[model samples]
Target: MNKDYFKLTGEKINIEDLSREIVSDSKDEEIKKELYDELVPKLRELHAKLFAEAKYGILVVLQAIDAAGKDEIIKYIFSNLTPQGLKNTSFGKPTEEEESHDYLWRINKGLPKRGEIAILNRSYYEDIISPKIYDTLDSLPDEIKNDPELWNKRYKQLNNFEEYLDENGFKVVKFYFHVSKDEQRKRLLERIEDSTKNHEFSFSDLEDRDNWDKYQKAFEEMLNNTSTEIAPWYVLPADNPWYSRKVATLALIDVIKKINPKFPEFSAEDKEKAEKIAEQLKNKEI
Candidate 1:
């Protein structure tokens, strides 16, 4: 994957300028084969090393508009991971208790331990994006709604929090699935029309779709403001699940390789004791 096609870091993004799908279905088959045969195994192997080392953590944030393949990523990629060191968390509207704390408080509590991987489905960014779309504030002073700089301040706070995590040996990998309005409409309609998928439809999805432009602007602003060197965001063209998954798997493998976790070494005394034990067992064989 040529990361420049999707990687956003301090560069302003126009949501309309990105591709919704880049590869043909024929090519997608080859990419799918490579992912299952090559990349996924490598990811599993690297995760083992990371778990053994107990040194660093990986925090993967999956942010997207409705029906943009977030669940598929979790099902195909994350489900293949070792459950011993992996956690998947999804955030929705905050509870009253959550509202009492600072916006990032619940997020901080959900962070993975060293040598673990955490997948946050919809994250603290919801505090910024949904409220902007719906005009709902949870217990905040009324003036905050009118403050033009509030968005910037929230972005800075998130950036700083991510930088702190980076410094503390955790790498935050963010993926924003950029499904176009037309594709979204198709997916939403499928949810309504297909009996098997009827469970997926929600009236709120339609309301949100009605404010599609506002959501796009909000996402673009977020991409420009919060993508940093330590915690960059990758925008995936998600109209085709194959293309997005291929790119997502590649990006994940790249980061794990960069993390480069290794198994711990044994001390000289322990090695000697193991050799002695082996010798004793060899001599005492029945």
Candidate 2:
């Protein structure tokens, strides 16, 4: 995947200008499969190295509309990672404690420790997008709720927070799964009709779908305002599950490769002790 086509770092993004289906230049399914097959093992290897190095952390934030395939993409691409090194958190409706805190408080608590990879299925961005569309700002403080510049202020806060993470050795990668309205409807219907997926369907999903245009505007503003050099957003064409998975996988691998985590170097004393222990093992000493 050409990362630039999907990346929105320091660029104004118009969701209308982006395709929700596979781009014309996207690779065929065969090529996508081949690339995916190659990338997964490489990602696993990098993730292991990252865990051992304990020098950097990775935070992957996934945001999408209903039935945009966030769950599927995360499962397929990241489930291969070692449980010890990877943490996946899905943010749904906030709990009482969470609701009492600032929107990013739960998100902060979920951030990865050094040398770990944290995947957020839905994140603080939801605060901006969903609430903006639904006008569900009653829970917020009056200053934030009533401020005309609330969205802009929130964007600045997010940018500063992400920059702080970056400066503190956490690399942030965000994905916006861009599924078409028709595709989303198709998937939502499948959820209702497919027995195995019935549990995933809810009346609220349909209600949210009714505000699709509003959500799109909110998403576009979110992407344009918050995509920065430290934490860029990738808008994946999500109509084709296979293609989106491949793109997401490739994007992650690209970031990890850039991070270039490695096994920690041993100190002189540690190396001497390791050699002694190695010699003892070679001699079959208990």
Candidate 3:
């Protein structure tokens, strides 16, 4: 695996220069199904070790444009894992109560506990990007919104936030589903044409389409400013959902491998105690 293939090697990224589809020999579905079939099991194994060790947790933040298959691919990747300590949270538009607090406050609800794995479909990330696109920051102070350095400050705050999470034992991994403008147009149209998919379409989606460039610029700035060694970003080419899933699988496993959790070891006395209890149960001696 190329250690930095999915990472930002430089301080600046021109979103226009990025490829929206991976170069692959196999079919789109085969890319994910075959390449990821092996790694999904490895992900589960690592997840089990993570839970058993109960000393660390991981936060996977899925950031994408509309119709980029963030939800679809997440289900495909983690579908088979036991739900015991797994958490999936989608943070949509803020409620009135959420709007009353600091931008990162609502994130507390989506955070994972030690021994748990959490997927934040959208996260405190929205506070940085969405408001930039819509040009609204009612949740924030009037003074800050008018400042020229508001976004840069927010980016620094986000870096500090993730750094805090890392210090407290939660590893942060971010995935940006990089879909091209043409592919987004096609998918948005498909949502309108397919009767089964009509529910996914809305005029608001088109509203976002109008500001696509603004959103791209916001994404580029966020990635450049906030991507750090402790919490790196993986840019997944999302025009082909399957291909993106395949790449995401590799990146996911790579991060978990680095985390390298192991099941806890027992002391001799604890092991003997457990063995005796097991033997008593086996012999039907209550």
Writing each residue's lDDT as its tens digit, candidate 3 over 170-189 gives: 99989898998898899989
- Residue 229 lDDT, candidate 3, scale 0-100: 88
CA-lDDT, candidates in order: 0.87, 0.86, 0.83
Worst 10 residues of 1 by lDDT: 136-145
Off by over 4 Å in 3: 1-3, 24-26
The TM-scores of all predictions, comma-separated, are: 0.93, 0.93, 0.93
Candidate 1 on 1-286: residue-level lDDT in tens? 6866778778877788888888777887898888899988889888888888989999999999889999889998888877888988989888899988778988876688988999999998898898888877748886875788888889989999899999999999999999988899899999999999999788888888899899999998889889988898999989878878878777877888998888888789998988888898999952
Q: Which TM-score value belongs to model 2?
A: 0.93
What ranges in model 1 sit over 4 Å off?
Answer: 143-145, 277-286
Name model 2 segments beyond 4 Å from true: 23-32
Compared with the true structure, what per-residue lDDT tens digits does model 2 show for residues 1-286?
Answer: 5768888898886789998887443555675666557878888898999999898999999999888988887677788887899988999878888888888898976799999999998999988887877777777889779999988899999999999999999999999998899989889999989999998888888888999999899899999999988899988888877777777777888888898888888799999999999999999994
Itemize residue pairs with steric clashes in candidate 2. Answer: none
